[model samples]
Target chain A: MSENHINISTNQPFNYCLHLADNSLIMGHRLSEWTGHGPMLEQDIAISNIALDLIGQSRNFYQYAAQLKGEGTTEDSLAYLREANEFKNILLVELPNGDWAKTILKLFFFSTYQYYLYQKLINSSDKQLSAIAEKSLKEVTYHLRWSSEWVIRLGDGTEESNKRIKNALDELWAYTGEMFLPSTYETEYAENNIGVDVSSIKIDWDKKVNEIFEEATLPSPNGEGLGVRSFGKEGNHTQHLQAILKDMQYLQRAYPGCEW
Target chain B: MILEKNISLKKIWQILEQITDPEIPVISIIDLGIVRDVHVDENNVEVFITPTYSGCPAMDMISMNIRMALLQNGFTNVKITQQLSPAWTTDWMTEEGKEKLKVYGIAPPVGKSIDQKYLEELKVECPQCHSKNTKLLSQFGSTACKALYQCQDCKEPFDYFKCH
Candidate 1:
């Protein structure tokens, strides 16, 4: 829970936690773009709640990461004060919210990954991370279910819906490779049971994605390394992330330490 | 700082009972079964809470309120630890809390915990008309802890504090 058990490497857990936080933060912002714009009124509210959940998850990680940093850092400072290049979130999360089909499919992909990741993380020797993962796993379960249901509905429904989901899968497939690309901390932390082995989740991720896509009659879009792997984990990102930060970090940049 | 072995957990409970959930406003933290543990240490009081939802944003406010309440009530040092094991379920919400939710126009959670496959098929009684004919509009609702439902009988939409 503190800086005590992490004998592997001090920066690993902090960096790991920061990456998780950044992913959720950016995903929350992406999901928020759906506010008041969902296909139906019920869906509008549903997406907002999912966004809130992601934002809240990010806050927990950020708060913990801030504590780990221990030099008077706080959640707001970590979330809002950081420059675009400094964030370590994978590229999959920061892409633009394209269409309803795109958003739902993207969400399905991420939620599936999170579901498997948290399933393993819940058993982490790092108690705080374990607790956070356990708690997050429950929420992600619902998210996976909701988004997967939509993917199925859209994929099997009609010609137009099917076409959109197929296109989304192709557009988003390349970005997901970065999720499985292992970090250096995994070898040490995985040995200590304090962190997840990202590679371990890859099989589950693929199986889950394949099954869902199979059920929906959509082919697996992860072509044979057709897309270039962007090192978004190390802060390289598309032009889209800067635009997101322009809006997300605006108030914080304009008014430092301002609270509502 | 003198160790207060005389401090009672019941007294701490009384203090906690005064703190309402920031989001619901209708339910106290105790009513939602969030106050999982209370330890009156020598110089400090430690409270363990489990969040109703993993990402419920109100947890911070609730923790702050708890600290403030205890500090104001003479406990100088208060510690709040969030626990996530055995994940918090709607089943943890007290029966009294469930009643209050219905009175507040939100449907009380029906099951002890979610059987995810069956969640969609479960019939929830409408808070407004108490109709079992209500249909689920969305599994996610106003908050992560709720689901949106529509009562066919009364033709009204309500928030269901979803089970788990």
Candidate 2:
């Protein structure tokens, strides 16, 4: 081994990557549901590509997580073997893709938050965390732009489109809070300068989201009355995640030693 | 002896960069920023790389290319390590690489930078006439990372590398 090599250990940075990767993987799984159901062929391809991108991000993170654990576990083993309660992804990612409108709205909100989160992570003190954030930021930027454009078009287009988009926003608003809550590992990483403070992202997220909403002439979903508590950071997920995990882990679970 | 090793390693690096991405022939794997680190230990040479996308079928080709490139460069003992931490992103593309894409007649990704939210919107400049008067013909283009666009002024269709 080279002198510059560092041992993989159970540290805040490792957990941070795990959390980030898990969020993308779960959300990607949800988005994959819209593969053939998108409103148009072009839209279908776009959403599916996004789903693939997120899954790619998740695979990268999981690979790193396995390295950190220094176990013989591979990415598939970590993703498939983990229990539903063990997943640390935010609730926003696990929500069902209700309709095209709902899916875009979900993407809009989540991508907005991810933009800021990854931006901060790029400057993390931990070299590994910073490197991942730096690389992922490029892909996430496109996701944000793609989703935001859809939100504006759908919200301001036909009356039916407007109504559908608005309803989607209303339904998905309750789950947004979980994105900003700092997990225990996040707190530790922040203190150690290896992770970002999730709360700091709120201002940027609100500003950008508000700008898009205004441009689209859509009313901001009144989250005040929703009163949804954050649960994702603490591994408390919605019922939706259970079903998602069941489907996602099916092949891996059924053929425990299978390799493709 | 140490200086001789460093010189040999540098030669190997140059040979490895000649391997182009199987999918995008215009850009080499090193220019794509997927090649992470290279190390030479005694008689063994190891290259660290990350995949362009997870489950990307092209990775198998990339691994094979590395081995072949090293063997051609006189390094018989070669190993490739795949690192997944810090997922691969387009931001890693070198400025020179972006220019190469433009010269190849494919529009390079345009934007301030990529983040999780709100990527910079780039109007597809005509790859032929360099005009901003372009309209998106379709979101799905030749591949997953491209969008089909037509330049109104030049009346030519081209692919825009969607910022991803």
Query: What does candidate 1's lDDT look like per residue over A1-260, in tens digits?
Result: 32322334663378778888998999989999999888887798888888988988898899888988888889888888777777888898999899999999989989998999888988987777887887787788889999999999999889999999989887888778878776555546677787788878888888888888888999875444325554777677889999999999899898987788
Specify the poorest-scoring 10-residue window by lDDT in model 1 chain A.
Answer: A1-10
Instruction: Please provide, for model 2 over B34-74, each residue's C-alpha lDDT reduced to its tens digit, 9 standing for 90 to 100.
Output: 88889988779999998665545578899999899889777
The residue ranges of model 1 lying beyond 4 angstroms of the native Cα positions read A1-8, A222-226, B1-8, B41-44, B67-81, B84-86, B114-120
- Single out the weakest 10-residue window by summed lDDT for candidate 2 chain B: B112-121
Give each model's whole-structure lDDT.
0.83, 0.79
The TM-score obtained by model 2 is: 0.83
lDDT of 1 by residue, B1-164 (tens): 23345445668889999999988889899999988999887767899998877568788899999999998888888889987766787878899999998999998888766456535567899988888998888898777888888999999999988777
- The 10 consecutive residues of candidate 2 chain A with the worst lDDT sum are A1-10
RMSD of 1: 4.0
Best by TM-score: 1
Per-model clash counts, in order, read 0, 3
Winning candidate number (DockQ): 1
